[model samples]
Target chain A: MKERKSEGNEVKVRWYGYIVLVIAILFFSGVFTAFEGPLKALDFTNLAGDFGKLGTLEEGAGSLASNFRGTGGAGAKDAWMFAMTLFPTVMFALGVVKVVEYLDGLKAAQKLLTPLLRPLMGLPGISGLTLIASLQSADAGASMLNTLAEEGEITEKEKNIFAAFQFSGGGTLTNYLSSCAALFAFMTVPILVPLAVVIAFKIVGANLMRIYLNKVCKQ
Target chain B: MDKKVTPKKTVVDAFVEGARNGFGISANSMAPNVMFAFVLIQILNLTGLSDILGVIFQPVMGIFGLPGVAATVLIASFLSMGGGVGVAASLYSSGLINGTHISIMIPAIMLMGALLQYMGRILGTANVDNKYYPQLFAICFINAILSMFVMRLIVSL
Candidate 1:
């Protein structure tokens, strides 16, 4: 009974520590944004010019009166171009994950991650794979958790932790590309800082819930 | 009456079956999610909520080594995944932020996902007991706040 109380206290201390850390970071982020104002404004004008060029290309295509024109218009073509450029990388990542799974490489991964996870996050070893899987695809990671639950590879408590991990980590290739591409174009400090803040909050938020749920909820 | 043989299920059938059994969550949820995303975007645009959120987060955003207006993009990211991307694209096209800012924001947005509401569906599908859901959510909220802080620290250093 005494040990349990100490454990509970430890969790509380950790939780508060995280909270304080987050607040401090936000305060600092605000200062950083203030410092970056002028450069960001300059970048904004450059971005407008770049977008104008893209618009001109679209207008040029619209002026063309060929039989095969509309379907192959600049906007449509650009979208396709973007897709083609990104798809190969996604496919390659997927293929690598698939091959690894087929060879039971995940089991080895799980074994390796177990020690670190328990101490750092209170997550079980097998959950390491689920966490990694989530980084690639939310649906795939969730499905993996479901499979593990069905197969009894992890307990219900562990599954909840995995769920929280997924909640925190699940973002696909497309998300990364678009967000990055947009921010890169502008060089605006204002636009970049908050995006970073919220994302960090979400990740930490999800993980903290995982830890909390593990402790308070019954298995 | 003579001998009969059973045909094997095709790959597609097997695949469908696997998805059905494995996911367990309703595919129909996508419709609501998409619809909500649209509604959220419209509201943000109509009310100029994006700008407000940006202003609100500005002070806190400084430590993270990002600009104040980034809050708008972050809010967009939260309302709809695609909307956030659209905001990013527009910002990029407008030349508001640089490659480094973009790099920093990208990971942050990816880390956040569609947090609050989406988490409900996720936890629901996971069949997490209702009693713990609220507490878990609280923790998630706190975690997100902390994640922002950590990202700021990393970028600043």
Candidate 2:
């Protein structure tokens, strides 16, 4: 009897330890203190017109006006900058995806991801490539899934599930590493914490979407 | 596995085909979508229409700790990430928003950005029926809102 009681206590302690570990991970990932203190300290009303050595806010406004006035404005410049920064990455990622598809690399990826993703994502193994492509461009991922659906490798239901997954935060890596990452470069806080937190929530959102699709869109 | 000998294309052929497919999709679909959002937001900013929209959305955005002016950024983001980035950069450089705001807002923005094009180009190109577009969009939007709350919680902690 005493041995059994001790064994039960040990199991309880183990469970407590696991719970503590989970909380620790959450804390370290910045899930607990994400935007609170910083937001309270922000001055959102005044346009900081001259930040990071950029021209005054008035000049910026003028540039924005010029952009619309058909005189090369800040608006036009930013638009050009956006395209220059983003489209190349999109093109590169899409090209890589096409090559992977053409070479039948997806089959290998599917085989590897099936056992791992089946239980976690409720998706077929082949949809793994789609997930990875989504990290680059959601469009690429969606197109890949469509191709799979056309080949009859995945059903309409699975397509919806995969779409939900990709749709939640598509182009995650690309956006983070390029555009969003640039935004964070000058911040006081560490980038990893927010990155980890966002990724974790995206997974949650994706799985929630999977459950929703399963219940409502039964095929 | 019946590994049938598939006709192999040369390296140059594979590369060329992939490049064409990539460039074509971006130029045909993605580029137009991003450009549309970019131009529209610029027009709105220039015309001061964004301020009116910002006033309308202030209360809603305030609930999430965002400034009223964020309405314009959010609208632009809802159309494309490139637009979102452009707006965010302008706002940031102008001192309208700071790093903390950007950090908190980034996740939700990433999740919610590019709705119209994502639905029309990505899913449509996949040949999904038009009927499901609304439902899919709702799912993504809800997910983004939920992530916003999560981001808020993270920042607040």
For residues A1-219, write the lDDT of model 1, one tens digit per residue: 123321111222322343433433343233433345554432322222321122233654555422221222222233333333323222322333333333334344444445677666666565666664555456666776777777787777777766766665354432332323333333334433544454445445546665565565536
Q: How many angstroms is residue A193 displaced in model 2 relative to the true structure, after the best TM-score fit?
A: 4.4
Candidate 1 DockQ, CA atoms: 0.13
Tens digits of per-residue lDDT for model 2 on A1-219? 123421111222322344433432343233434345643222211111112333335644554321222233355555555444444444444444454444545334444445666687676666666665666676787788788889887877777667766665676755554455335534445545555655666566657667777787667
Interface RMS for model 2: 8.0
lDDT of 1: 0.48
Interface RMSD of 1: 9.7
DockQ of each: 0.13, 0.21
- i-RMS, each model, one decimal: 9.7, 8.0
Looking at model 2, residue B19 earns an lDDT score of 58
Q: How do all models score by TM-score?
A: 0.52, 0.60
- For residue B79, model 2's alpha carbon misses the true position, in angstroms, by 1.5
